[model samples]
Target: MPMPRRRLILWLATAVISTAALPPLYAQTPPPTVAAAADLKFALEEVAARFERDTGQKLRLVFGSSGNFYSQILQDAPFHLYMSADEGFVFKLADAGKTVDRGRLYAVGRIGVIVPHGSALKADGELKDLAAALKDGRLQKFAIANPEHAPYGARAKEALQHAGLWDAIQPKLVLGENISQTAQFATSGSTQGGVIALSLAKAPSVAKLGEFALIPESWHQPLKQRMVLIKGAPPAARAFYEYIATPAAQEIMVRYGFAMPNEK
Candidate 1:
C-alpha cells in the first residue's frame, strides 16, 4: 500500500504550487468606504493619509451633509463607516438598527464667523459688527449652511438667534448646501462673510482667505461629533474606527481646531 513513491511526490508538488498561487491574507482585506459629514473634509483627509502611511490601509471617503448621508444609509448605501458632525445622527442610525454598535464621541466642534479679506465686517465682538454692517447696508450678503441638514448651520442659526440678529440678517443671508460650501461662499467672495465650522477656518487654505472669530459656545448646543461602524463592516473599517481614537489621530484633529471630547 505504501509503494507509490513517484505518484505521492507529484501530488505534493501540485499542492505546493496551488498554495503559492493564492494571495497573502493581508491582500484579501477589502478597503473601507466611509461616509463623513462635510465639516470633516480637511481634518479627516489628514487622518486618513496618516492611517494609510502607518497601517497600509486605504479608505474611501464620501463627504456630504450628515442628514443627506443619513437618508442615503437608510436607503442601503454601501458605506462601512459613518462619521457625523452631530452625534444625534449616529444615535438615530443606532436606533434604526443600522450600526454594529453604539458609536463613540470623537470631537466637539465650534462655530466661527468668517469674513473675507478687505470686508467691512470686522471681528467686532462676534455678532455686533455683523449687525452693524447689516443695519448700515454695508454688508450686502452673508452665508451660512442650510440648517435643515448641516449641524454647523444649525449651530450658526442658533448663535445668530441667541445674538438677536437672526431677523435682521435673514433677508441678506445666502445659504450653502453644507458647511464646506458655506466656507467656500464666504472665501470665494460670493458673500462678504459666513458662519462656518471653526475647523474649516483653521485649515491653511481657508485661513489664508479670511479671518475668523469663534462664536461663543454658550450661544448654541454642543456639537458633540461621533463615529460608528455600519453593520457588517470590513476589517479595515473596524481598524479605522479604533484608530481614530488613538492619540496620534486625535492629535491631528486637535491640530485642525477640534476640541477633544473630554475637553471643556
Candidate 2:
C-alpha cells in the first residue's frame, strides 16, 4: 500500500476502536420519581410495577401526606410527578406554577370508621354508636389522621360534626400523620378504632384487622384525588402521567376502592 493510504487506514481503525469503547447514551437515562399521597401506596405500587413491566421504565414513589408533599415540592424536592389526595392541593401547586397544568382527578375517596377484628362491634357501625362507645368508656381511644394535613382527616372530622359528636369525642382522638398511618393506629391496636379512607380499609392487611362503616356522603364534600406532572418534567415523566389515566390503571384504582370522579 502507498504510505499516505496506509496512514489514513490506521487513523480510521483508531476512530472505530474509540467509538466501540464509548458507553451507550441511553444507559445514563434516569427513572422518574413520583411523590404521592400515603393512601395511594398499594394501588400506585401495583400500577408502577405494571408500568415498569410494559415500558422498561421504573417509577420511584415517595409517599406522605399531600400537604407535606406540597411543601416539599415548593422547596424543590426531586420529584417528577405528584398525586394528591385532594384536588385542592394540586390546584395550589398549579396556581403557584409548580405543576404542569390543572391536574387530572383520578379518584373519589370515601371516609369510613374502622374497628379491630373481634371487637364485638356490629357491622352497622355509625358515628353515633362510636360517640356512645366513647362516652360510656367502651372505647377509650379513637384514631384519625391530622385534620390539618390529611383530606381524610378533614372528612372524618366533618362526619363527626355532622353527627353532632365532634366536641364530644375530640379529647379521645389520637392523631396520625396521614390516612395510612391513621389506619395503622387502628389496625395495630394503638387505638380502639379509627376514621380512615375506604381505600386503606379495603387493603388486605387492613381487612384482616377489622370491618369498616362507610361514612355517609352527605357528611362531607367529595374527596377528589388528583395527579399532575411537575413543572419542567421530562418526557418520561409526562409519559408516566398519561399512563396512569389509562383504562388499566383506572381499573386497578377501582378494585382498590376508589370511585370515579363525577364527569364535568
Q: Which candidate wins on lDDT?
A: 1
Q: Which residue runs does candidate 2 get wrong by more than 4 Å?
A: 1-21, 24-26, 120-125, 262-264
TM-score of each: 0.88, 0.88
Error of 2 at 114 (Å): 0.8
- TM-score, candidate 2, is 0.88
Q: In model 2, where is the ten-residue run with the lowest total lDDT?
A: 118-127
Q: lDDT for every model?
A: 0.90, 0.84
Give the per-residue Cα lDDT of candidate 1 at 82: 98
* Model 1 misplacement above 4 A: 1-30
Clashing pairs in 2: none
Tens-digit per-residue lDDT, 123-207, candidate 1: 5536888888877888999999999998999999999999999988889899988899999998888888999898898899999
The CA lDDT at 209 in model 2 is: 90
